[model samples]
Every structure is written in C-alpha cells, then in structure tokens.
Target: MQITLPRIGTVAAWRQQVRKLAAAGIDPQAVIWSVGAAAPDLFATAAPAPGVATPLMLSLEAVDGIEMALLHSDPERFSRAHALVLRLSKREVRWGDRSDPLMRRLLDQQKAVGREIHKMHGFVRFREVSPPGANRRAFAAWFEPDHPVLEAAAPFFARRFGDMDWLIATPTLTARCEAGEMRIEETEARQPPPKDAAEELWRVYFASIFNPARLMVKAMKSHMPQKYWKNLPEADLIPDLIRSAETRVRAMHDPSAPAPETLPGGRMRKKLR
Candidate 1:
C-alpha cells in the first residue's frame, strides 16, 4: 500500500499514483490505501475500517494509530513501471523541513509509519534458531497486522541491531537484513519458531515490576489482553502480580509492623527480587 501526506497538489498526485499503479499491472484494489488528514475534501472524508482497503490519513497528534492503506495482495511483484511508480511517488512525497506545513504533514506520515512498526514490534514473536555453525542468528515471529507496513517496518530491526543478520517474515512480505543490506520478499507461511529461555527471564522481570494494587483493570486490558498472553510471560504473572498488591501495600504501611529482615551491617537482607 502507498501512504502519502497532504501536499499543495495532492489531488493530481493521487490520480497519478493510481494511474501509475494501473500501468504496472497492479490491481488498484490490491494496494492497501493510506493517506493524511490534509488530503483534499475528495479523499479526506472518511476513516477506513480495519482490514478494508481505503484511504487512511491522520493529523500529527492522531498519527499514533492512523494510516491510509491501499491494500495489494501481491506486493514485491512489481514490474519496471511498478517499481518506477514507487520511486516517483516517494520522491514526490519526501519531506523538506520540520517547521514547514508540508514537513509537519510528512512527520504525521512517518509517525503513522512508526506506529505501524511499533504494532509489529509488539506482535511479532522471535524464535530461536539452532544450528551447528551459523554466523547469523535466526528467529521467527507471526503477526496478522491490520495494516500494511512490512516494507517500512524492516528498517526498525536494522536500527535496533546494525551488526547482526535477521529475517522477519510476514504473510505479505519476508524481510532479511544482513551484512548491512536489507531486502523484502513475498511468501506464504513457514514453520513455527522455537522458544528462548532469556525471554522467560525478561517476562518474569516484567511481571515483577508491575504493582497490581495500582491496577486499572480496564485500562490495563485495553493495552494488553488474554489473546496475547501466551506470547508474553508477564501475562501469566499478571493475575499473581495483581493479587499481591494489597498485601504488599499493607505490609509496608502497617503501623505495628516489625523491622524488616536485615543483615549484619544494617543493610536490608531483602533481595530486590
């Protein structure tokens, strides 16, 4: 899908993008549609529903979760014209300055990009790859993101780990970044990933840090839910974490409480854990 910001001549540009896609054998229906709040009256009138391909756009503040998606089932199947269309569209939509109205619009576009990446970052699970003499590490994650951002999301891995090789496969795209280069491919499903012990430790830490007595259950569920629990070790501990809050609070505040267990030097003998 192509995402764009509102520019001075966006209407003409939008028309050109569709035409460009058509010329390259891309079914307009196949592209996921995304756009910006500043789009002209013609396209900025409605919000697209999840999984549906429609014009997605956003204001700067709302950029957190908004996008303009034009869905294409066949990504990476570009011919010469299709590739050229993408190149041309990117050049036209490039940002110039932070202060300019155009730049602000682009920032909104990029924030939508960031939010898209973040959603994948949260949902994509990494699996361990066991091999005898592998130089590059391998992991696997599965996600059915409601939006199309796999093309833009791969770079996040590069930024997070510039020296390693990795593969992030999505239903629509399979991305690999190694030896300072990144690429994407179209693929179907693959094998499930293996587990990691380190991830379990991290999940335990996450669950430990959360104080359940402060729970806003509704708000907490809004950010996370049972469906994602299996992938998150902390999720299992949430119930326990929540139950312990009241007892922990009362123990610390009880006026008649005895002194805490301490060591010889007068330091608390308690483990942070």
Candidate 2:
C-alpha cells in the first residue's frame, strides 16, 4: 500500500500514522511511503481503525534519536526510520549498536541534525525592519539550512526573543514569532535581505573581540562550518582577519610597537610598526 505523507512530516504526524498502521498489523514492508500532500491513492486500501491496544513503545533515547533523524535531508530517512522502528517493536534489540549499519546511520543523521540546529541558533542574524503603524520593531533573517530543522529549532528563538517579533526564512520553511507565539510554515527560495545599519556595528564588534594570537583555523571550522559563513555578518571579514592575524599578534608582542592612534568616534587603530 502506498502511503503518502507530508513533505515535511513532524513527529506527531508520524506517531499518529504509525499508531494506525501498527494497530492494523500493517508491517513496514507492506507499505511504501512517499513524501507529498496527502491524497487518496487510487490503489490504496483503507486503513483500519486504530484499536485501543497500547502501541509498542521505544526507549526515550531511541525515540529522541529517531525524531531528530527524521529531520535530516535524506529522502529515504522516513523509510529507514520506519524499518528500524518496526524491528525495535518486534523484539529486543540494541538500538544504539554502532556495529549495526542502520542504527549507526540513524545516529549519525541524528547528530548531523543536532549540529544543524546549533548552527542555526548561532548563525541566524536578525535585521530590524519597520512597517508603518507598527508599535514594536520587527526583525527578519534569511537563512539556508542543510536539514529540515526550522521546526525543531524555532522554539529556541521564541524563548530567546520573546519580547519582540521576528521571522526566520529558509528555502524550505519559515519560522515567525509574534507576541510570544511562534509558527512554522512552508516557504520558497528567497533572496538575501537588504543590509541593516546594525550589521556594521556587529562587524566592528566582531573584529575588535577577535583574538589573533589564538588563531586555530582547523578547530574554528570544525565548530563553525564554512557552509554557514555566507549568512553571517562577521564571515566576510574572516579572510582579511586571518591574513592579518600574524601581523596583529606580532605587533601586540613587540615592545617598540607604535602607540594606537585615536580615530574618529573615539576608536583606536593600532599602527603595526
């Protein structure tokens, strides 16, 4: 039986559908899953009523892992997760076994999604925008994420910026928060937003706080991947910063280094002598 799920299915939706399938004794092999709008399949059989019987439960760790794994960009993630869940329900198995390819892949996907979430939290830069007649200022950001994680990652923004309205738009989805409530919805490709005045200040602050003496390009890339650089305000300055790091650090250590000149706006510019 062909079962068409939503293009971006959530944990609750999958849980509800899985409960019905499990109650009806519909094994994973008997059903083929495709992601799209839910439409009546011409050759599909009607699903049976979900009985009152308690469905099989997975451990909390496994459940969390599968939920995050499902958010991965892999097209076959649903099928793989479904198969694993079926095997888990049928008998006792080490869900965390790395020796098992399926389990290992799922765990890896889960970790990738987790890292994407962290990146989104760190990289999303909101720009203030004002519409006529608006009382409180509204902010917006455009981002491109590697995984379908905006749904899972939106809550952090809602809690962090509860006092203001904000929108985070991505290729696949958008998260909007207003008056302490957050909503996620589908979106298409979007162009980069206009430059905000605040970005300049952020750039200056980033440059000032950067420690050239502690430069570690490899370790920095591991934590802050290059994929996210385009969306970050401080990223464009990275190349120049890295190139001049040695000079800056050497000047700082030199006893004969020229005194810093006071620039306009009380900023100090070190003259590398």
Candidate 3:
C-alpha cells in the first residue's frame, strides 16, 4: 500500500493512516510513505480496510516523542516512526531504551527538532512591512530552519508580538498573524523581506549593549550561529566589534586614559579629551 500525506497537519494524517494499517495487520516495510506531492507508484495497491477497532495504547510520552520525531526533515522519519509505534503498542520495545537502536534514533531526532525550535525562537528577525499611516503596524521575517519547525515555533512569535500584525516566511510555508488570528499557508516568496527604517536604530542599540571587556567569541558563535548572521541587522557590526574588543578593554583599564565628560541626565559623552 502507498500513502501520500499533505505537508500541513502531517502528524494527524499519519496517525489516522497508521491506525488503519495497524488494525489491518500490515507490515510497516510493506507500505510506501511519501510526503507532499509525488509521482504515483506504479505497483501500489489500495490501502487495506481496517479489520477491527484496536486501541494503539501508546503512552503520553510515546505519543509526544513520535510527534516531535516526525517533524524532522529525514525522509525515513515516517517509516521509522510507524515501526516504532507498532513495537511500542505491542510492548516489544520500551520507550527511552537506549538498547534499542530504533528507539535511540527517534529520541535523537526528537531532540534535534527541539533544538531547531529553540534556534527559530532566538534567531528570527522581523522588519516592518506595513505602509506608513496604517492603523495596525505589521512586520515580516524570513527564516530557514533545519527541520519542518514553522508549525512548532510560530506560536511563540504570536504570543510575543500579539499587538502587531506579522508574518514569518520559510521555504516550505509561511505563518501569518492578523487581528490576533494566526494562519499557516504555502510560502508566497522565497526572498527575504526588505530592510526597514528601524533597523538602523536596532543596530545602534546592539552596539551600545556590546560589552567588549567581557567578549567571548566562541560563546557568542555558539548562541548565534554563522548561518543566521546574514539575516540579522546587528551581525554586520560583529566583525568590527570583535576586532576592537581588546583595544576597548585596554582603554577601560588604563588609568591614564582621559575621563569621558558627563553630559546632562547622567549620560556620558562619547568624546574624550
């Protein structure tokens, strides 16, 4: 039997199909699983009718793990998940048992999906896309993730930027929030959004918060990977900031250095005597 699943709501679709196949006593290896639009398989047969209603009896942990692992970009993810689900339902394999290779692989993939979600939350940079004088401000962002994580990661943005209208576009899909309602649709454009006026202010604020005396190159790179730098407005200043960190730190320690003049409101002037 051959099963082709739509990209959106894939987890729900897979669950429904797998239940029927399991009830029919079909082997996971005997079925061909393809996601999105694909050429029809020549030798594919019609799916078997479910023989009887049998509860899968999967634990909450197992269900969550399977759902997260399915979001991974690996083409074999569906088959592997299906196999694991069968084993789990039959009590043939224990959840979180590193002794089983299949269980271990699924666990690792689940963690990978989680890490990708974290990166998406931290890295997406939005720019204003709404025209001036618009009643509600709108913004847009472009992100490329290692996994199919837009569904998993978009809710964080909705809660954080609830007052404004925004959209996040990825290669496969786009998530848009308008009037407090969020919708997911096919991507309209592959290119990143245009730069807006506020980016300069964001860059300046980034520079101001940079602490040269406490610079840690490796740590910074770990938190913000190089792949995401191109999309960030503050990333352009990183090279210069890193190069000058030592000099700035030295100046801070040098007692002979001229004291910066204090301006009104306790702000220090940038110019030094």
Candidate 4:
C-alpha cells in the first residue's frame, strides 16, 4: 500500500495511518510511505480496512522518540519510524537498545532534531518590520535549518515574543504570530528580512561585550557554527575580533600599557602612546 502524507502535519497524519495499519496487521514491508505529491506505486496493493482490534499502544517515551525522529531531514525517516513502531509493539525489539541498529539510528536522528531546535531558538534574529505608527511592533526573520524543524521550534518564539507580531520564514515553511495567535504555512521562497536601524546598536553591543581574555575561537565555533554566522549582524565583527584578540590580551597584562582613551558615546579607544 502507498501512503502519501502532506508536508505539514506529517507526524499527525503518519500517526493516524500507522494506527490503522497496525490494527489491520499490515506488515511494514507491505507499505510504501512518501511525503508530499509523489508518484504512486503502480504495483502496490490498496490498504486493508482497519480491524476491530485496538490499535497498537506504545509507551509515551517511544511515541515521543518516534515523533522527534520523524522530524529529521532523512527521507526514509517515515518508513524507519513505522518499522520501529511495529517492532516495538510486537515486542520484537526493545527501545533504546544500542545493539539494534534501527533503534540506534532513530535515537541519533531524534538527538539531531533536538539540537536543531536548540539552534533555532538561539540563532533566530528578528528585524523590525513594523510600519510607521503601528500599534504593536512587527518583526520578521529568515532561517534555514538542516531539518524541517520550524514546526517544532516555532512555539518558543511565540512564547518569547508574545507581545509583538512576528514572522519567521524558513525554506519549507513560515511561522507567523499575529495578535498572539501563531500559525504555520508553506514558504514560497527564501527571502531574508530587511536590515533595520537597531542592528547597528546590536553590533556595537556585541563588540563591547566581547572579552578578548576569554576568547576561544574553537569553542565559539562549536557553539555558534559558521553556517549560521551569515545571518547574524554581529558575525561581521568576529573575524576582526579574533585577529585582535592576542594584542588585546597582551595589553590587559602589560603593567605599563597606556590607559584606554574614552570616546564619544561612551566607547573606548586605546592610545599608542
């Protein structure tokens, strides 16, 4: 049987379909799963009607793991999740068993999705997009995640920016929050938000807070990957900050070093003399 699921609400659709298949005692190998509008399998048989028996019941942990794994970018995630669920329901395999390759892969995928969600929460930068004299401020951001994670990550933004109207656009989907209501829709294209005046102040603040003595390029890169740097306003200063870190550190240690000169706007400038 061929099951084509929509890109949006994929997890819910898959869950409903899996319940029916499980109730009908359908083998995982007998079903073909595809997302979006894909060509149908010409030779595949129709899905059997759901039986009177109750659908498979799994532990909450297993259900959460499968849902998270399905959010991964892997095209085969649906099929793998279905197979794992069947195995789990039949008591053929145990959950979180590293010895089982399928279980291990799904667990790893779940972790990857979790990491992506974390990155999305920390990395999304909103630019003011509100028009003149607007009642509530509006902002927009563009993000490209490795996985289709906007659905899972958007709730954080809604809670964080509940007072304002905002839109976060991704490659596959867009999350919009207006009047405290949040909704997700398919994205037409990848278009970044326009630069705003506040970004300059943000860049200045970022540079001011940077501590040369605590600089760790490797650690910084690990926390803030280069892939996301392009979208950040402060990232433009990173290269120069790294280049001058050694000199700044030496200045901090030198007993005879000249005191820093204070400039307008409360900024600091070092004197050569």
Against the reference, the lDDT scores of all candidates come to 0.50, 0.79, 0.85, 0.86
TM-scores of all candidate predictions against the true structure: 0.52, 0.86, 0.88, 0.90
Question: Could you give candidate 2's per-residue lDDT for residues 7-47 as a string of tens digits?
Answer: 55466677777777777667665566666666566766655
Model 3 TM-score on a 0 to 1 scale: 0.88
Model 4: per-residue Cα lDDT over 182-266, one tens digit each:
9999898688989998777768877788898999899999999999988888788788777667767777899686645434323
Candidate 3 clashes: the total is 0
Residue 201 shift from truth in candidate 3, angstroms? 2.6
Per-residue accuracy of model 3 over 14-121 as CA lDDT, tens digit each: 999988888887888778888889788888778644444445889999999999999999989999999899889888999999899999999999999999899999
Candidate 3 vs candidate 4: the TM-score winner is 4
Worst 10 residues of 3 by lDDT: 261-270
C-alpha lDDT of residue 7 in model 2: 52
Give candidate 1 regions above 4 Å deviation: 1-17, 20-68, 71-114, 225-227, 255-273
Judge candidate 3 at residue 39 and give its lDDT: 83
- As for candidate 2, its clashing pairs are none
How much lDDT does candidate 2 score?
Answer: 0.79
What C-alpha lDDT, on a 0 to 100 scale, does residue 173 get in candidate 4?
A: 91
The candidate scoring highest on lDDT is: 4
Worst 10 contiguous positions by lDDT, candidate 4 = 259-268
